[model samples]
Target: MKRKIGWVLAAALLVLLAAGGCAPKTPTAKKKPTPVKTEQKAETVPTYRVVADNNLDKFKQTHGQYRTINYDPQDDLVSLLPESLAKLKKYPQTTTVRAYVTDWQQASVQMGSKPMTVLTVQVQKVLTGKKQLAKQEIRLILPGGFQPYGQYDKGSIYHDNTIPDDEPVLTQNNQIPIPTIGSTIVLPMRKAAQYPAKEYLAWLKAAKLTTAYVPADAHSMIWRCNPQTKKLTTNNPLREKELTKWAGQGNQTWATQYKRLTAELEKQL
Candidate 1:
């Protein structure tokens, strides 16, 4: 009877051991950690506090687009002259128009309830294929009025909102007819205004800006001047330097011519 009891106890012990072995495992230690995202933060966007370009942001644009919705378009003299001067050879009076960026024209260029820069623009020529653009180009378009006798003296751009009081001025545009009415005037001067109208047109045609590669790189910069349309588009270091030097020289020349025209126009007025 003692031996039989011992055998039964051994069998029970074996069954208990088997059940314990079949139990689920307590998980092994893991070293893989969850990654923390850093790139999705808000500070990555590009923004430049370019208020220092000429301290242009000093004033406020009171007559906003929404606020002045009821105002007559005729009330603006500066905006009126460019179109009006289409048929006329000279300005009715000795007028000056200042240039500014398109967006901040009212607030930044405005003077104590007045505008500091009354600018103008005209499309000389538009070229549509690929053209090269230099590092420094004049981006601002002025509607100051362009005449055979007029010029934009970039060298004499003295004050914060001042254009060289005299220069061969032209507006910037990429479309329209060749040698469009007021563009190539009979100045009897070799140094006349020119815009890459054909190149600009080509750019418009192919949906390109200056070249076949696209103007993606230069899209953000201020256009120092429209591309010279005559050349086959290619990046040229000399071209860049020449553009800057030529602009200075051209502006100086225009200053001399401006003095002459201002006097001539003043006498006529």
Candidate 2:
């Protein structure tokens, strides 16, 4: 009975082992790794534009006063008043003027406690306030701390001051030079009605006008005269040719009459 019981127990154990071996095995699935996320930097764009009419009032307010040099044939440096200028209703008290930059001086101004740059330009032109200027040179003051954008020589032409939309604006470096030099710029000028003429003269004298210096080859549209009207006009083709020739030959007398007018104005200034 013991032997039979042992055989039955062994048979039962074998049966259990067979059943365990025949059972289906389950497979485990592999997990995928999460991808890393990355961030990108944003690009910077310039928004500043050259000062224009839209902001001119604001600029004047912040800058203190808006002043411009008047091109007068009588008191300023001018030899012969252009017919166009002479014919204008406001000839001597013009709102606009063209000039040639003969020299530049950087000055320091004490505004409150901060020292700032005041650009003084020695210009030669034919018009002023009193009489025709004869080869005269005078110092004109730009009140703000104006710095030029590019290099300029003695003979650079300053057309008029007008900031166009296409004009380049200040960069991140804040190194933009004045656009009036080296080109014909149409700058809008404002009369200082509140300031007396004597006061204006005093301010100019304080600028310490540089020594008289004129380039032999310097020629500007200020000397051109319209043949048809026989008046001072910038549109004279013949005058342009003559100016070009004089400039090529380094002739300082090409605008002799006009330059002489400038001399008288210099004395008055």
Please report how far candidate 1 places residue 154 from its true position, in Å.
27
TM-score of 2: 0.25
Could you give candidate 1's per-residue lDDT for residues 1-269 as a string of tens digits? 99999999999999999999998999999988889877766665212123322233332333212111011123322211122222223433221211122222311322122221221122232221111221111222211223211222233333223333333233221111012111111110000123345643442334212211111111111122212331121122333454457567775452343234333322321
What value does the lDDT take at residue 194 in candidate 2? 29
- Which segments of model 2 are wrong by more than 4 Å? 1-97, 111-131, 146-194, 197-269
Stretches of model 1 off by over 4 angstroms after superposition? 1-5, 18-56, 59-130, 134-136, 139-269
Number of the top lDDT candidate = 2
Per-residue lDDT of candidate 2, residues 1-269 (tens digit): 99999999999999999999999988788888888887686764212112223244454455443332222112222323433323332543442333433333334433222122322222223343423332333333332233222211113365334533233222111111222222221111223332346754454345443222221111232222222433443323445566567768878564554444433323322
Q: What is the C-alpha RMSD of each candidate to the true structure, in Å?
A: 21.4, 20.5
TM-scores across all candidates?
0.23, 0.25
